[model samples]
Target: MATTSGGDLSHFAISSVYGELLSEMSILTAVETGLLEFVCCLADGLAPQAKGHFFGSRNLGASGDTMRATIVLVDDISRQLGVGFSWKNENFAFLEKVAAW
Candidate 1:
C-alpha cells in the first residue's frame, strides 16, 4: 500500500434498483484508456486504488466496444409487494478495460 498527503485514486459510488449503472463513466473511461490495469475494491463500492483507474480531471475522447467491469459491493434485493418482481439497491466499483488479454 502507498500513502501520500493527497494521494491519487478515484472514489465514490451510486446505488440503483435495476439495470447497469455508473455515476460517471467518462473518468473511468479515461483511466481505462490510460496506463492502468486493475482496481482495488471495497464492500460498498468505495475504493482506495484503481490500477487502470483515475482520480482527477482528464481530457478523453470517445470509447467504443470495450470491456467494462462493475465491482458490486452491496446488493439488497426485495420482492415487490404482491408482484412477481423484485427491487434492489446496488453499488459497484467500476473498471474499464484498456487492453485485451
Candidate 2:
C-alpha cells in the first residue's frame, strides 16, 4: 500500500477492512454534512449493481486540527456501510483501496 503525509503529520490515513455485504443503499447514507455529504449524495444515486465507491475528505483546520477524529469517522462509516474502508493522502500517487486483509 502507498502512504503520504503533509507537513509533519498534517494528515494520515487509517483504514480497516470489513466483510462485504449486500449494499444496495448508499454506503454513506447517514452522513448529514461536510465534505462527505456530497460524496454520500452521489453514492446514494448510484445504480444498485455498482461494484464500488469512493469517499474522500480533507481538513484545512476548520474543526481545530482533528485529523485523527476524521479518520475515525471514516472508519465508523465503513462499519455502518458494511464495506472495507481505506484512505490516501492527497500527495500520494494513488489512493490505496483496501479490503479486509
Candidate 3:
C-alpha cells in the first residue's frame, strides 16, 4: 500500500465528513430550499480560494454546499441556546468583538 502523507489524511477526513453530511440530505422541498439558501449565505462570506474541497476554511461559505449542512447544525445549537450569530469581515472591530466574547 502507498504511504499517505499528513496532508492526504487531512483531506480524506474532511471529504469523508462532507460526503456523510450530503448523503443525509432528503428531497423535501422545504429542507432542500433552506439548505440552498444557507449555502449561498455561507458562500457570500468565504474568500474565493477557501471555496475548495480541502486545505481551506471549513466554516460556512468556504466549501461547496457543505456549508449548508454546517450552518444548519450551527443554527440548531445557537437557537436552542438562545444566542445570536453574526459574521463580520476580518477587521479590527470583528477581532474586538470576538475578544470581548
Candidate 4:
C-alpha cells in the first residue's frame, strides 16, 4: 500500500490485489467520537482479525533555528484504505477494491 501524507488525514492506495468490494469502512465513522458505530462488513463477517488501539492526536513543537514541528490529527478516513483500526478490541475492517496484492 502506498500512503501519502500531506497535512491532515493522509491518503492510502492499495497497490495490490483486485477483487469485488465486499465491504469497506466508513470514512465518517469516528474512531473515537462514538457516533454511528459502523465497521467494515467484511471484518464483521470474517474472523482472525487483529487487535489494537486507534488514536488520533495532534501536537505542536518548534524545530531548530529554521525548522518547525507540526502534527495533524486525522479523525477521518479520507481515502478508502483504512478498514478498521481497533486491533486490541478485535474491531477491524478492510476494503478490497480494484487492487493487486
Question: For each candidate, C-alpha RMSD in Å?
Answer: 14.7, 16.8, 10.8, 17.3
1 or 2: which has the higher TM-score? 2
Report the lDDT tens digits of candidate 3 across residue range 6-83: 487667655774455544556633345444544444434443322232222233224444444455665566668665
The digit string of per-residue lDDT tens for model 1 on 1-101 reads 02442322212121341112433455665444332322222222233333223232122332322222222211211122232221112322223222331
RMSD value for candidate 1:
14.7
Model 3 worst lDDT run, 10 consecutive residues: 92-101
**What TM-score does candidate 4 get on C-alpha atoms?**
0.15
**Model 2 collision count:** 0
Where does candidate 2 stray beyond 4 Å?
1-59, 62-65, 86-101
User: Which candidate order results from sorting by TM-score in descending order?
Assistant: 2, 3, 1, 4
Which pairs clash in model 3?
42-61, 43-61
Candidate 3 Cα errors over 4 Å, as ranges = 1-5, 27-86, 90-101
Q: How many clashing residue pairs appear in each of the predictions shown?
A: 2, 0, 2, 13
Off by over 4 Å in 4: 1-38, 41-43, 50-101
| Residues 1-101 of candidate 2: C-alpha lDDT, one tens digit per residue | 23244432332222222112212225543222333433343334332211122232222122322333443565577669976533332322122322211
Compute the lDDT of residue 90 as modeled in candidate 3. 52
lDDT of the structure predicted as candidate 4: 0.22
